[model samples]
Target: MAATLNEIYNARSIALIGASQDPNKAGYQVLKLLLDEGYEGKVYPVHPKEPEILGRKCYPSILDIPDAVDVMVVAVSAKVVINVMKQAEQRGDVKGAVVLSAGFAETGVPELVEAEAELVRIAKRAGIRVFGPNCIGMAYPALKLNTGFAPGIKLIEGSAAYVSQSGAFGGALLMFAGDQPCPQGFAKFGHIGNMCDVSNLELIEAFNNDPSVSVTGAYMEAVKDGRELMRIAAASEKPNLILKVGRSSLGAAAAMSHTGSLAGSDKVYDGAFKQCGIVRMDTVEDMTDGMKAVASLPKPKGNRVCVLTEAGGMGIVSMDTIDKTDLVLASIAGDTLAKLEETLPSMAMICKPDGYIDMTAAVSPEQQAESLRLVLADPGVDAVLLMGLPPIFRDAKDTAERISPVAKEFDKPVAVCFMRGESMAEGRRHFEENGIMTFDTPERAVKALETLYRAAFRNGHPLEDLPPAPRHHLVEKAVAQGRNLLEPEAVSLLADNGIPTVDHAFATSSEEAQDAAERFGGPVVLKVVSPDVIHKSDAGGVKVNIRSRSEMADAYDAMMSEVASRVPGADIHGAMIVPLAEPGTEIIIGMVRDPQFGPTIMFGLGGIFVEVFKDVSFRVAPFNEEVALDMIKETKAFELLGGVRGETARDVGSLVDLLVKVSRMAATQPEISEIDLNPVRIYERGLAVLDARIILSCGN
Candidate 1:
């Protein structure tokens, strides 16, 4: 990865390719913004038609420019972009080029894609790093250099660097950040148009090493190299916040059209994010707010919090919100409680939030200040939440000023939530001006606190090595057969990989079925096995819990009759008889090839609840134990697996092990298209696969 925009903030000069005299064009804006931002570096505008842009002399081409340009901004048509890039490569002094044009692989046009590829090849050969093929350009606020068409009058000087795939979305977020009370800064918003050579992962790695950037945030439609992104994010010392769009089918389609990216399933992305310890947010607001909170707030020693509120109702709401955030309300210590009692009348209760603070007690500024001091001094409290203070008391400004110094003494985070409109406005302004974090609502305050809390706990766990891929006995034959494996065959294949499956034998006739049942055990299960009868239960092709040979024969006959009636054209493979397996718990583990993300593994509660509850978690193939455990815990089934109502806990350890094995198998074998292990029975001592289906990839 090359140095990020922040690392090269002191670049001596920049060359503007396709510079134009027309102020309305993006090229003109690029030249104008650089000048307006007070970039100290010399600016060279390369244009064939214009001799001067914004009163600065413009050269006809890069070859004509006397001084070496550190960075070149290519804002030209797609047809001429290649030419501009070629000229940039020939320049010995140019270190990097930002391609601000759009026509690339995103158009899904063959010529444009080929052209973009050639541009990358040229840059690589010349040792010139390329930023984008379709991007809005770049900006470095610290140096007052803006290479993009978008102006930066609203941008405030801060320590966070942002990157995005969508130029408009980046601009919108920058605009939104301008309105926020906290001072937000961006080294540059690199709109990585089509990510021809430079990718989000590379940028993240660069930012991770950049000293100026204290925190990093990204808004991505899709990740080109998910594995690399995970690695960088996991290793980053600074907080990495991500707001990924295109999780839904409709959104994924839009992302594909916008960036020529294949946005993967939401579940897969979620699992990857969790494993990487990236702070994931749903909206831009959350992303901005989360970044601000993580950057500005002091880390809480613990989740314990003390809520100080004037109104009882607001206190209750605050407590409820706190509970949802997984933070514990600190119990009022005896000395702190005594100090509060001394400051207030008997009517004022000083317990937690709901504890007493009399509203009509004619509170004085000195008394209010003293009460806040007592709360801050409490050894039991790690943080304090002051809520519902009306502006009428002292204009909220004076009150905040008086309490700010005392709150700082304890070195603890203090969040304020005002219910009244005027009070909130006054309080927010005062707190922000004084660098004291405040929120409009208790929920928002709790959310901010939660981000910090999670970041603290997210001490990156070491990535465990995944077990080697399991060997399957059925892959070669199934591929040769050019057909999906039946349940019996699939089970046999799984059994070969050390997966436990019930002992069973294929019976060609009713007499054979009875003989097989007696050979296996007296009590056995009979199921009509055929490739066409995928859903045996739906077709009434399965019978279980048979006690005798006669019962087994009857079940065999009934299963055959039901299959024949259900699908008259289907060929009967014959009945399978196995000893009745002890049923403890049921779970499902399956695999399907995702068009964008390749092999994906799914785990959930087995049977009817699988669809009804939609309780499933997914992870991309070749996952370690930690990743597999994260997937298992993501589903509501985790509660059941943990043992509800005195039930013995299921073998979650074994289940995760099995999932890891399956994921590796999927990753190693391209011939396997889909693998379904439904209703795998979990016993007290062991596990048994009751059914399976393996669908080979087409032409395998």
Candidate 2:
């Protein structure tokens, strides 16, 4: 049977090939690290020449090793790497392999790429789960193992598991981190280069299931399957923080619809991560900051944070930083604020601006603890961010000692920012020793609290509804007709899915338009319906405010003429004649099928606001009601929906229902590429979907 993840990654015994006496070589360096770190397992070295290296007996090959090997570490040239795998297969003692060789797919050479693929095939047949052919390696410090050849990289035993895409650069970065006094530590570390064998998703799945992993992180250049990533990250209970690079625009030249035009790949990733409870880190520094908070602190109850500072500048800086994050300053209770004012020093400014406190340098260690207890007990506070400078007279250690116990009394997380390195060194040391995280800068400290909040609040709130079955007929019809669904057909589909569109009638002539207008006994709107014309307004095919028969006739003639001149040789269908929707808030609900992540729903302000501001939010298909409401609240349109400018509140609950139904429709209909419902007039009681467009992918 194939080895499980624990057997493969947490192997008790290892066979290190290319064992060398030369310290400069990677093989020699790797052996020294393993032996020096006191790996709690048997070390079997394989070498053709050296009989004994670093006090470990060397065999010519793994096949010659007498003891059963739980895993094999191959550090050899690319040309001869397959030969080692052959030996691993023949040995039968090998359970897993970590090929440390380069010159595979990473080189972008055709021959090397094929060689890597062939390597996976061979390893799979032998039931050996291979890590990398052009990668650094793996490290599980709890097991006292550092299997990679990256020298000077310290793997501290922590709850976070880190995976990287680039081995050399990633490994060097980790090495740099290790060189520092307080390095960014991890429980498991490895790089999945080229990913011909094991991918980042596989590692994420492994981490998600592993009990030892408290939170997970990765450095990804690009993702091949964003849908699967959403699924895996959504399922993971622990926080999944990823530093996704390549935030530039997509490679596509143009899009068929507005939904596709605004669907930047990076935006899709951002929205998908938010929906799935993945913490998207911006830089390597951000990852380090997020890791410390996620690893050390307790999960915060909410995003509300109270900032307590010994310096005014630090408090100001912290509040400014909090303004940009998902975190909000906690509104200290009135009674609590009164207590803080009475107990603290005369210089202390209590709640001068909402959730802030300026204790000044005059405060002592005892007062600090008392203040911490008061805020921790307050119902408004969910977390605490304490910023302290060097005390004027008292020792810094005294402040740390007094505050640590009070901070630990409550389950809420606390992040300490102690500035002036050497001056506050004792205080910072005490905080670290007491299991409270410390940061040098106010920005980094704020980030730690923000990450903690997201972990506790944003992670894993996905809707459990199963995806509806795919509608094959719609795809087949679109393909057979060689065009996307018509506006009428799109409207019909929405109605079938229980979304109410406007009252309208199809009109080929001006008489039909007038008749449709008379049915409403008010002004009507004429929108050209054609599968060929995606943008009716851009093509001069839309006419509104037609009151009488004469106006309808004139508008019909002018619109047809303009459309003909603008788009020549286009097959034009009849226009949709409907009553002008009652005045209400306009919203744009759309769906864009991302290449990596399929069918994502978008919500934002309608008309010019969406076009100009691009203020929108997205959720993956078939999301829950909570996710749906979050998407609405994330955009500027949310304010307008909640009775803006003396207007009555629009039907937000009805809108949420509409969004859920649309998400289900998009999720079930796999052939659909885009769904745009622009100028969806949302009233106080109901909504009117004035225009609808659904694009189907014929590529299948």
Candidate 3:
């Protein structure tokens, strides 16, 4: 059981169990931070040896304290932590605890692990939520409570709540708050180490509910329940920025050793995060900076942004970078263009109707601010990127002040890039202090706006909540059979789930293969059907475009012989023959059961494109037609499907329908672990599943 966030953060009385007078000890720092931060809550220092500490009488234990303690801070040795927690548990008034000690389960020692477990058991029995047996702890700037041991740090007042898995990282982020520009400082900071009781999801939910906390940032190595996190993220309107590490094999192992957390499949995490509208950040710097920007600005209504720069080269650079992202150069509105043309100097050029607003170096800070004000007011533009304005001119501070009021007036986002200047630091500080997001480069400013636009779009059009998939009996029957499904069986299962599959007939022998090919009366594709074989092509078990009995017979014999040589002990389960469909673009639809996020669906250009380009897009299961369409468009090769080079467009609606059905099947059928429908040819009006391989879970 976990204690409510209110009990932990808004506690009226807090007790520091091992409060010390020594300057070197963490306990001493914790007490000093609480007092120095101007915490309004009652503080009790429980130390047996000290008569008084920091001008306050020290109690022997939590029980000895005269008043009730809402939260207890335990910074003691591993040997005595259990006893301290037990005493707090017996006190009954302690609603929650922040344990600042190590050498527990993370040490991988049995006795220490048992000791931590016992501490948790006592806390749970006593109805007290615990933060960590090994963590830096929590800091609530709004309450002026600093329970962690980072010295000489002043908490910032901001709307973004950051919770980190690593205590040291959390401390660093908090310390670096002076560099991050926000209207206020951070709403709160937490280091949820080990998460034996209170989890990251709970902390996220708490912040999500806080009206003041507009955005939440997390540095999570792993999550205990990905589904719950997704659910909470989906339900909350607040944007979440997450920097999820431990993606590579080496990083995963390191994360496990560091926190005893299993960093699950990175692909699944990506899909789930996108599905739930949580913005996935690439690095801690990105997360921290992005959260600051997102928390301050209004959600851009669209991805269209207009770049304003006094320097022509900076404008060009900003436009080039914006082109690479999901953002687009917005078309300037006629009225806004007219206003710019009237107000600008003769040398100024409103050259691009879409994207860049070129106000030459001759333009003053006042003219620049006016141009920005008009552009931000334009209906076509959702956001504006001010590049190299104040930095180039000597009046950086005055320019920032001039632009600040206009930026705050508009509902859209405004980002500024200080390319270079002697007053770079002072100008940025001024702009940030006045509520404008400032970046060092044009590219970074554009990148921040792109992130804001994406978060806005996702939040507006959220992922659909699909009902539980209807029972799939075909899948149940296949799982009952103790082996992976053959191609024919996999195709049948797909068809049963309303996903279109090619018509096919199975044959056990060469003569039967010939008969089956003859039945098709045209060129047919023949593939070896073996549950034991995963990659049939690698084993030479596939032969395509067989037109006659002789060819079919030769292909069958060659396939069997090749399989025998390639995969010696594999069991042969006959062959499947289907009519060769018209030549068209190929698409690959796949599903993999991720350990943490359950099923995830993938779509990409099939055939060699999948292998050579590796351009694929993934989304969590239960996705709808709209989501499937987005997945299809996310691929780099989407232009090929959209009738590139004067080619006729394939039936994209049919492809989308197929993707949705496959997603449903994956979500509903836990027995099926992986499904690969490769080279699903898309013709003028229809598509055919050329091949399918579905592997059942061994656990089933």
Candidate maximizing TM-score: 2
- The global C-alpha lDDT for each of the candidates, from Candidate 1 onward, is 0.73, 0.83, 0.80
* Ranking of candidates on lDDT, top first: 2, 3, 1
List candidate 1 stretches off by more than 4 Å: 1-10, 151-155, 249-264, 311-317, 344-349, 352-380, 418-430, 459-471, 595-598, 621-629, 667-670, 698-700
List the candidates' TM-scores in order: 0.88, 0.93, 0.92
> Per-residue lDDT for 164-234 in model 3, tens only?
89988877666655554333478888887889888888999888998878888888999877777888888
User: Could you give candidate 1's per-residue lDDT for residues 1-700 as a string of tens digits?
Assistant: 3444443445678888888888778888888888877887899988987878788998999889987788888888989988877877677667778888888888999998899899988887776777787887566676776667754445456667777888788777776666655445565556677888777777777777788777778888888667667677778888788888875642442231111112236766776677678777777667766676676667778888877776666777777788777588787778878888888656665673533343323555566667878877877777777765663546677766776777777777777766536545665677766667777676777777777666665544323345435445566676677666766787776776667778889888999988887887667878887877767788888898887788877888888888899988787788787888776788888876666556778888876666567677776777788888888888888888788898888888888778887877777777777777777776556677777777777422
Q: Which residue pairs clash within candidate 1? A: 134-193, 158-185, 349-356
Candidate 2 regions exceeding 4 Å error are: 168-185, 333-342, 391-394, 459-476, 510-521
Show the colliding residue pairs in model 2.
none
Question: Candidate 2's residue-wise lDDT over 58-126, tens digit each?
Answer: 999888888889998888899989999898888876888888888998888899888988898888889
Q: Is candidate 1 or candidate 3 better by lDDT?
A: 3
For model 3, the superposed segments whose C-alpha errors exceed 4 Å read: 1-3, 180-184, 249-264, 338-342, 389-393, 419-422, 460-481
